[model samples]
Target: MEFRILGPVQVYDECTGVLIVPSGAKQRALLGALVVKAGQVVPAERLVDELWGQCPPTNAANALQAHVARLRRLLPCGEPGSGRPHHEWLVTRPLGYALRLGDADTDAGRFRRLAAHGRELARDDPGAAAGVLRQALALWQGPALQGSGQGTICAAEAALLEENRLVALETLYDASLLAGHCHEVTGELEELVVAHPLRERFYELLMTALHRCGRQAEALGTYDRARRRLAHDLGIEPGPALRSRMESVLRRQDPAGAAEGAARAVAGPATGTGPVDEARTADDAVAGAVSVRMLGEELARLRGHVDRLTREHRELAGRLDRLTSSPVAGPRDLAS
Candidate 1:
């Protein structure tokens, strides 16, 4: 049996071509809660709280039990004498219930595993990584846990799953760029930039793709748009990576001159040179010194960016801890 919760909550039996889906919204929510926290006993109180949320019925426990019974009957019962009973899939514990998946496959689990594998492949085999990541993304039929009741657990899990999907998308773009598919991904990256204006990484990738395709002017224009958006929305400037990419576009037109200048600056005074040569060497040394100072400033900015990212990461981790520890009130559009 393959339990699917990536989209609608349903259980499929490949052997018999049977699809068992809980018809009730609450039942789907109940099954979703169990599936997300599968292999562990979710306390009865938590389940009740998620179902009714501050307005639970007087006999909430019994009502919950009734719902569980209906869900169990709706699930598949394995084989007649296979020794694997349907009840084994949803077992009642002293405090609550557990979904013992046993050998059953889940699209969520497979998507995560495949995403990890694709990330690993991204370093050395980006083409292969793109393929694997596409496969992982193809598992999503719609919004995660769609049609499930608007419970805290399901809502939070759906949001987290959707965030994971976005991360996988960013990884896919990275792999696509590395595999020399810049032109192909440029359109999607542009759309992503518009959809997620705050995501500076998308802007960076789009700029890079445009620059690689000899659209230097457009690339610079994209950087300007990103800069203006960041400034207007976040009251901040672009980070080091985006700024560096923009600088690359600015210097794209005179690559030979830039390379030769850098070489001359690094080489210092030429040996046995004339007075004019010595003067030019001195100029080159001054340019080198200026370049070194500019690089130091850029490094300082990068360090600040790193520090900001670290603080943001810590804040997000703390928020996640709180979300997992307690129930969040309100419904979020996970599909968005």
Candidate 2:
């Protein structure tokens, strides 16, 4: 049996496809709350406060009891005892409700544990942390309840999950850069920046990628774009880290930095544009500037190719016209 509470509260039995959701919003809320705090007994008072929140009715306990009864019916059972009344799945106590996935599993609980592990790995080994985070993030199928609509508990948990996902992406990109995968990381940063136009970090990674790829002008342009976005949206200049990166690119960049996977290297191309054959990549801010720089480089490369093609076309057209006017199917009498 699988209990999913992230998007919606769902119980699926392998024998059965999709189990019916416990009726009533309050009942669902109760179940979701328990799932988010799975294995830990939530105090009854906390559940009541969350459910009612200073506006409970005169018979709130009576309503709670009815909701609990419905939830008990929805839960999966092991073996039923014949003689007396049985309460195997959900147990009522003075404190509150406790859910045990034990043999079964809950998405919300797994998500929380994975998120915690990801953070831990991030602090210890960022590269490993990125891997863990990817696993954790993949668990999210869709919006909480798949947009089935959630009460306070599910909404809060969903938001937390989304925030963790963003953090994971950021961390993963950072780890890739450190692992010397700037070429691979650039595309991802561009997509992320496009998705979150106002986010400066994605631009930061783009700048780094551009610099690493030996694109000084494009890297600088990325910084300019980021500055513009920050100023236009937030009414502020680019932060300290971004400003420093821009300055580094302004000065002479070192190609060795590129070869060494230097964090803030603005480097040179393979054709050797400078003495050191070097370039600098943006590194300071949000740590995702390489992606921005790669985007600029791609645009510039395209523009240069277009200009070259246009010039060649013009030259060829002039030579063709001269040949039509002068020579007549002859190459200096075959130059024999």
Candidate 3:
């Protein structure tokens, strides 16, 4: 049986799938409240505020009674079996209700315990860390209640659980990297960074993994992206750790620091020569092709022009020759 808080307060019984939350906002709120304080007491007044916030409806205690009655029907397996006809996981308290989880079970609780163990194993035996974290992660079939907990108080609880989930993921990634499984961390890290642009740790892990994989340029680019995102979204640079990591990367010092640095210098100004080289190679394949086309057109025009000019020059030369070769003819011509 699983009582989820990350989305909505859900009851998942292995034998009975999902249990329905009784109708009415107060009733639903009771289930959520019970899940939050699972295995602990939730005072009636606290349930009132959690359900109605600052302005609870009249007869709030009575309303709480209705919720409990409904939830009681859905008692999880292993709940305390009293000698009396009624079994009580939620016993009548002097002030409020107590959800007895020993009588119940929750995936959330199991997941958290597993995550704790995984974190403990992260620095020592990463394989064991991966195994534990994976088990913890596997407990989440989907977002709690498929995003059912969007209410004011419910959302808060959901967000808290989600944060823990991400933390577990971070530890998981660390373990994977230590186990020399850097390649496997990319997909998860990419999603995490996108989902949480302000989280510098995710960026750090991403940068480091990229560096370790010999993708130094990509690593630095990732850092630049983090800087830009933080500046754009939060009007601040990446926190100290990320900024420090970036500096080390640019200087090619301590490339293997706490966070990975690709150890590559920042990209320099490009001269557009990559395209130029490609164009030059392609044009060389058809050497002088363009010049030949132009020359062909110019040659036709020049040849015709030159022939006409040459014909006129020959005519003038013939007249000059007559005067020089025939002396008398030349004198008579001059007289005429």
Q: Report the lDDT tens digits of candidate 3 across residue range 87-199.
A: 35677789889877654567778888999999988888998999999999988765653443344545666677788888998888888888988888887788988988888
Model 1, range 1-336, lDDT digits (tens) per residue? Answer: 888888999888776687888888889899999999999999999999878889999999999999999988877666587555544688999999999988788899999999999999999999999999999999998899999878888999999999999899999999999999999999999999999999988999899888787676688789879877886899788898998887766545433334555566567646666544555555455445544664676577668988999999999888667666766533452221
User: Which pairs clash in model 1?
Assistant: none
How far does residue 295 in candidate 1 sit from its true spot (Å)?
A: 15
Q: What C-alpha lDDT, on a 0 to 100 scale, does residue 304 get in candidate 3?
A: 77
lDDT score of model 2? 0.67
By TM-score, the best candidate is: 1
Q: Backbone collision count in every prediction? A: 0, 31, 1
Worst 10 residues of 1 by lDDT: 327-336
Q: Which parts of model 3 have CA positions greater than 4 angstroms off?
A: 15-25, 76-86, 142-156, 251-336
Q: Rate the local accuracy (lDDT) of all candidates.
A: 0.83, 0.67, 0.69
**Candidate 3 backbone collisions, by pair:** 208-260
Q: Give the CA lDDT, 0 to 100, for residue 2 in model 3.
A: 56
How should the candidates be ordered by lDDT, best one leading?
Answer: 1, 3, 2
TM-score of 1: 0.72
Model 1 misplacement above 4 A? 79-87, 254-336
